[model samples]
Target: MPIRLATTADLPAISAIYAFARTQMAKDNNPTQWGKSHPPLDLLKADITAKHLYVIEEAGNIGGVFAFILGEDPTYQQIDGAWLNDQPYGTIHRIAGNGKIKGTFSKALAFCEQLEPNIRIDTHQNNKRMQHLLEKNGFTYCGIILTEEQAPRLAYQK
Candidate 1:
């Protein structure tokens, strides 16, 4: 699989992957993380333009999307619990699978690890799947942190 920077032309597939993610999150009882208007096209366009958005192609198709931001994440500055280290980190946000593909997080993590080992990620308290994926992939819980929207999320670091 090759992970590449996302472009405007990839919006349709990215939107579809996120739609599947929202539905799955709802079904898993984590309805508050992403709402109906979340990850809006405009926001994605901004990510693409900012060079933060990435897409992973698997088996000749776009199978995953995520935003990898380097540096201190403002929302993570106030975690209730301490981080494992005070080193610089990269934050992985808005990771979503293609619905038809498995191990999307694994692929994204592998890609991120190649660039930076000290990584951070967060998920809704109710997103058990993601929590498991994080833990299974070597992330340690760092307690709750609030998003810019004032929503509390379970933070983790690796």
Candidate 2:
């Protein structure tokens, strides 16, 4: 799979992948993490405009979407618990796959790892599936960090 920055033209396909992820989250018993309006189209559009969004294409299909943003994330500045490192880092957010492809997260993580060793990501406390994937990918639990909505998320670092 080739990872490339997302363009406005990729919105529809990106949205579809996120939609599938939302549905799968519900089925996995993590329903409230990404509600109906979570990761809104406008936000995705903004990510695209900022060049922070990316898509993994496989067989001419957009298999996944994610945000790999460099520098310190404002939301992560204050953590309820401690972080693994206080050095400069990049954040991985809004990572979702179309379910049609396997190793999507792994591939994305590999890309991020290549870019920088100090990578951070967060997921809902109830998002067991994501937690497992993060740990499996060599991320260690850091602590809780609140999102823009004031919802607490489990932070991780590698």
Candidate 3:
């Protein structure tokens, strides 16, 4: 799958993936995470315009999405746990995936090939699937970060 920057026009697809993510979060009883605010339409649009969204595509279909930012992740900076590495690095945020296709994690990991080594990311405490995926794909459990909503999230880096 090829990963490219996503546009505002991709909102529908991205929203659909968030809906799927909500279902998963609900099943895990994480009612405060993506389960609470889905589609994140406004945030989506903002990220798109900032040129921070990335999409994985194959056969003309979008499969996964990721957004990242540089500098200190405010949420991350306040974490109670220690970071695996203190080195400055890019922070990968909101990696949403549509169950419509597999290999989303692999596609996300491939993003690493384009940048520096110390990449950071976080997952909902209840997002077991993502936690496992990150671990399985070489991400080390770093610590936890509190979201703007005041929810604690498990953090990782690779």
lDDT of 2 by residue, 78-110 (tens): 998899889999999999999989999999999
TM-score of every candidate? 0.97, 0.97, 0.89
Candidate 3 lDDT over 1-158, as tens digits, reads: 88888998888887777777787778877766665576478888988898888888878888788886766778777777788777888888878777777878777767854665688888878778878898988988877788888877888888
In candidate 2, which residue pairs get closer than 3 Å at backbone N, Cα or C atoms, i.e. clash? none
Best model number under TM-score: 2
Model 3: residue 62 alpha-carbon error in angstroms: 1.0
Cα lDDT of all candidates, in order? Answer: 0.92, 0.92, 0.79
Decreasing lDDT order of the candidates:
2, 1, 3
Ranked by TM-score, top first: 2, 1, 3
Query: What is the lDDT for 70 in model 1?
Result: 86
Better of 2 and 3 by lDDT: 2
Output the better candidate (1/3) by lDDT: 1
The per-prediction CA RMSD against the true structure, in angstroms, equals 0.9, 0.8, 1.7
Q: Hey, what RMSD does candidate 2 come out at?
A: 0.8
Off by over 4 Å in 1: none
In angstroms, the error of model 3 at 115 is 2.0
